[model samples]
Target: MFATRSEAGDRLAAELEGRGVEADVVLGIPRGALPVARPVADALEADLDVVVARKLGAPNNPELALGAVASDGSVWYNDALIDRLDVSDDYLEEIRAEEAQNAREKADRYRDSPGLPDLEGERVLVVDDGVATGATATACLRQVRAADADYVGLAVPVGSPQSVADLEAEADEVIALETPENFRAVGQFYREFGQVTDEEAIAYLEGLGGRS
Candidate 1:
């Protein structure tokens, strides 16, 4: 198991460098992704920024992600799960609007300007501690694409094999240190998984949030 998010980030940076992966900017999904994205930005010599997406919880199960929606309205829905749950379209619409606002507020807290930077014609990488359902990542990638980034990708320390495979459709490239068959959750691969505070997460932005 990876020792910590920082260690995982370091290892992830190494893997990217070995494969000649490069980025003009690196964005970490706030709260948990900041620690991991810090090392990656330092290693890549890329500007550090934040991307925000909030998971739409399943009915009566807030922990379960039905999908995720980004601050800019970019979203991804787990059709299979929604169908299985028989979630109504009205509920989905309401929840998506609620979560989108939450994501925007989060991005605002971390960034002075809030939202994405000017990524048009630039290569961008989205870093996360790990992936479970990939709902958030998909939304984040869509947001990046909407910004007209020349290339958009995702990198993680570990992820569920199925989720990693599924994300291939969202990003130009998907990189993960591990995609174990036995993957139960993102925390299982991290030896030092802990919640990152908003204050702590903002520090990683390095005042490089976004440029006008």
Candidate 2:
């Protein structure tokens, strides 16, 4: 288990370098990922930025994500979950619209702009604390692709075996330090998994603190 997100980032960065992976840009999903992405950007000698997305929760079960939507309105839906839940198109549209705005606001907070940076012809890597259902990661990957990135990849410290396999179809490359079949949640593998406030999260971008 990772002692801290910073430690996870260091190991993840080393793994990426060991594999000779090159990234022109490293985009972290904000709040939890900034701490993880900082070292990766420094190691790769790439620019670091935020890629924001919000999960669309199931009706009356806000903790259950049916999908996620990016700041640019790019979305990834879990058809299996939606189908099993028997969710209607009307409910999906309603929640997507609401969450899309939330994602844009979050992106604006991170970058002081509403959309992603120009990634055309750039090698883009999306970093997160870890993958669960991979709903948000997929949305951000689609957003990067829509921006015409030359290459898109995802790297994480740990993830569920199933989610890692599913994300293969979403990016050019996928790397995980650990993918246990018995994984339950991303927090299970972390020794210090605390909720990151916006101020602390933005500090990673400002270069104030991250290694802690």
Candidate 3:
């Protein structure tokens, strides 16, 4: 296993090199993704940026993500989960509005623009620390697609096998370091699995020294 996020990102960048799909830019799913994406951007000699996605929580349990909303007002819902929870359509819309605003706020805090970078006719690699249900990743992918990227790829250090499969349908290419069968949570693979703060995320991006 990789020692840290930077190491994981470097290995992932090497994999991307092998595929011959050189990225024009690397987009991280903050705040957990920033550290990983920083190194990938450095390795690729490209710009590092954030693609903010706010979790759309269920009515009572705010931690339970029903879906995710992007900075550009794009929302992706877990239809199966919504059906299972019996969430009302009106309630979903309300939550989406709040989450969209939250994403925008976070984006503003992290960068001048929280939206996807210009991937027009460029290869774009979306990096996340890891994937769980991929609700947020789906939302991010939708935003990337909206930018009309010529190529779309996802690179993560580890992910649930099921989540990896789900993402493959959305991205043109998927490069994950490890896909464990007994996947529990993204944190299980990391020793330093702490939440990354907004300041830390922005500083990490700035330290990479270009396109920040």
Candidate 4:
């Protein structure tokens, strides 16, 4: 098992070598994804950037993510989750507006201009630590796709097999170190999994040569 995010990224980068993926850049979905993408960007010898997305939490139970919204208003929702939770369209719009604002704020804090990156003809490696329900990652993938990237690859150290399968339809390529069938949560595999603050995550990206 990898000792830390950097080590996990190093191993992941080695795995991504020469899959016809001429990496023009690496973008991490903060706050946890930034550290994981740093070493990969270094290994790929490409520019590093940051992508921010926020979970659109349920109105009553804010801990549960009904969907996610990226900085640019890109959203990916779990229809099943919303149905199960009985979330209404009006409530969803309210939550989406609040969460989208938070996402934009974080994006602003991380970059000079939090607007989507220029990916017209570039191949980007999007890194995240892991995926649980994949709602957030799916939203992120949509935002990246909207940028018109020449090629997009989704890379994570660990994710549920089903989550990986779900994301494959959204990305050109999907890479993961482990896809355990019984995966319950991403934190179950990490020993040092902790909350990453916006400031610290931005600092990590800045150290990796990240720019808006």
Tens-place lDDT per residue, model 4, 140-210, is 88888899998888999999999899999999999999998889988787777777777767677777323
**How do the candidates rank by lDDT, highest first?**
2, 1, 3, 4
The TM-scores, one per candidate, come to 0.95, 0.98, 0.92, 0.92
Give the whole-model CA lDDT for all candidates, comma-separated. Answer: 0.90, 0.94, 0.83, 0.83
- Runs in model 2 lying further than 4 Å from the true structure: none
The TM-score measured for candidate 3 stands at 0.92
Deviation of model 2 at 148, angstroms:
0.2
* Model 2 RMSD, rounded to 1 decimal: 0.8
What ranking emerges by TM-score with the best candidate at the front?
2, 1, 3, 4
In terms of lDDT, the best-performing candidate is: 2
For model 1, residues 146-192, the per-residue Cα lDDT tens digits are: 99999999999999999999999999999999999999989988777
The parts of candidate 1 lying over 4 Å away from their true place are 207-212
Lowest lDDT 10-mer window, candidate 4? 203-212
lDDT of 3 by residue, 1-212 (tens): 66666667777778766776678878899888888898788778878888888889888898889999898888888899999999999999998998898888888887775456578987888999999988899889888888998888889999989989999998998889899998899878776676777778888889742222
- Worst ten-residue run, lDDT, model 1? 203-212
| lDDT of the structure predicted as candidate 1 | 0.90
Worst 10-residue lDDT window for candidate 3 reads 203-212
* Deviation (Å) of 46 in candidate 4: 1.5
